[model samples]
Target: MEKVRQATDSTVEMPPATGRWKLIGPGIVAAATGVGAGDLVATLIAGSRFGYALLWAAVIGCIVKIALAEGSARYHLATGSTMLDGWRSLGRWTSWYFGTYIILWGFVYGATAMSATALPLAALFPILPLWAWAMISGLACALFVALNRYEMFENVMKFFIGLMFVIVAGVALLVGPNLGEAVQGLIPSIPEGSAIYTLGLIGGVGGTITMASYGYWVNAKGWRNPAWMGIMRLDNRVAYVVTGIFVIAMLIIGAELLYTAQIALSSGDRGLLDLDAVLEQRFGPFVSKLFLVGFFATSVSSILGVWHGVSLLFADFVRNHIKGETGISREGLETTPAFRFYLFWLTIPPMILLYFGRPFLLVIIYGALGAFFMPFLAITLIWLLNSSRVPAQWRSGWLSNGLLAIAALLFIVLCINEVIGLLG
Candidate 1:
């Protein structure tokens, strides 16, 4: 492999060309990161309430994410710059917004993610309390990320994803989904009073801030040039395909298990625990325990994914904005002060929230900030990829533009709904 100098003058080692199947790492990580326990719960709730009516929304959600992820990855390979770099190029305000958002979001998300991951662990082994397991989970994920690099992280995520796929999808199948109704779900129709849930399913499917991290993962995987575009596309496609399947499986469970029974689960991670009890009653302890283990895998994988991916974004922000670096380089990110600082920021400080509960004001702000991130991502990608900033050959085509526009509109509506909900 020869070193290729990007437009930013950063030297990236060009990885050897491999078959499409072999180029499927970052996407897997992205998929695993995006589909957490909350997503499953949301999908499950949608299925349980609306049956398969919103199944189209989940599939559309996957398609929208494919566009977002593809655009992010394409920008990195096209310009040899990170997404932060592109944002920086847009204006200083973008930098300011992201810097503030990352700090606040990570502070809150750290506690939430740790708690979610700890739920299944506590259920499986009730020796420890939830907060204790949360602290341990946080420490374990941070240590694993801090100790290893991209390859190990990706491999471990893949294993977790595979485990989740088998368990969740298997459970969905075991529930004996109504195939005819599920196929009907393919048509775009929203039952009355189902608007919010429909939008949520569409917008929330396998999406998170981790979608922005897709580019950083691409670079970490050593795919830094335009030549890897095809591979990136293939990788992105496979990621969402897997995501679609996982989400559909959850919908199946929700539809068959909960909807048919007219059982309503509570909101949040606790709902998953509630589901576990239901499973135990319906299918016995073994199947219920298997679902809990799968839940652990799903939740823990997100913790690890964010621990690694968002840390990279923070590292890039520091490198470009503070350290005066021109381009992103992988050498220092895993070991750099900024990287470790944010990693520590994500791990340690939030433990307080785990014990005492999140501050009300901070929760509000976090909610407002998070509500707008998807729209922010969608709008920015449209501006960056369609403009002269990206190379002419790599600029977004009509399909990309249309999909992104739809995503932006969808997220904007969702953001407004979020604000209204918060205010109400």
Candidate 2:
């Protein structure tokens, strides 16, 4: 393939310039943020419960992410509008759904993200309490977002993503995972009693609401037009490819080590915590520590990414809708008051949840809404990207559409399973 060029324009109205790696920015961060503790737990659980039976699903998850991320990037490139702006164009109902979802998702996700970041910290430093570490993680992530330039955050995320991949891939290699079983998983059979977890792994590994923020990241990276479209696709593919490998490595570790050892994993993020213990038991304390460091890097990168990226998205939603500032002609959303307001919402109010712990009701609602968000994003992207609004040059190809449709269906099934699980 010919090398795709980068975007040159800083102003919102112009098309992004041509070049490679030149426009790298928050899109990568958003990708990192979308893969959090819950995702890891889901992937690891699939591995532990059924070895490499879901490995193919995990790879499929990566492709699904690439499609969604590409759709988001295309939306921004074609219209030079944020995804929020595109949705608002659809109608007020879209805005209402988005607004309510963000408020609820942010409130609950803040606690969960922090707790995840803190787990590795607590594991590394027993001197500090888990709650204390959680608070510190929250405050630190918020402060990082508030103080730093977007480029700085992106570089940090890139570094951590590299570190995460190295550690995870290394462990997977060291464990002698069953490649034969892993290959078979690509065919997509549903294992008995394991459908729920398998679906969750497929849906969860792909992305979260943060994936919708891909445009903002692209915008931040100076990708402002159709010229940058090729590079944007490459960037999305590379990021998810790396992410897929990391997840597959985790699954292999689960299969080779955890399954072989016969360790019964718990249900949520705690299962990952349990995995940490099992690592120590099987491979010695040093390997466990290394895994914890990788785990901490993964979680903290996620916290910082969400704190920064989605805050940008929510802020843009407010700026575009409530403030009536939409399109490329206006000032960027990052500097708008609505952006700061959501930033504060992400940082300050969630501190309450940090101390008090998420209420049972809030957790339940968060799970239900959270489970449904992927399907919503997929369906919305398909609708919005295919609409007349998107420039024909940047429209998704049939292959992309097919992948995204499969993504939407996978998440729909996952959402159904979640609702059933929650209700039952």
Candidate No. with top TM-score:
1
lDDT string for model 2 (310-350, tens) is: 87888777777777666435345566666667767776687
Name the Cα RMSD for model 1: 2.9
**Which residue ranges in model 2 land beyond 4 Å of their true spot?**
1-27, 328-331
Q: Pick by lDDT: which candidate is best?
A: 1
Model 1 — TM-score against the truth? 0.96
Candidate 1: give the clashing pairs. Answer: none
**What TM-score would each prediction reach against the true structure?**
0.96, 0.92
Candidate 2 has a TM-score of 0.92
Residue 157's lDDT within candidate 2 is: 91
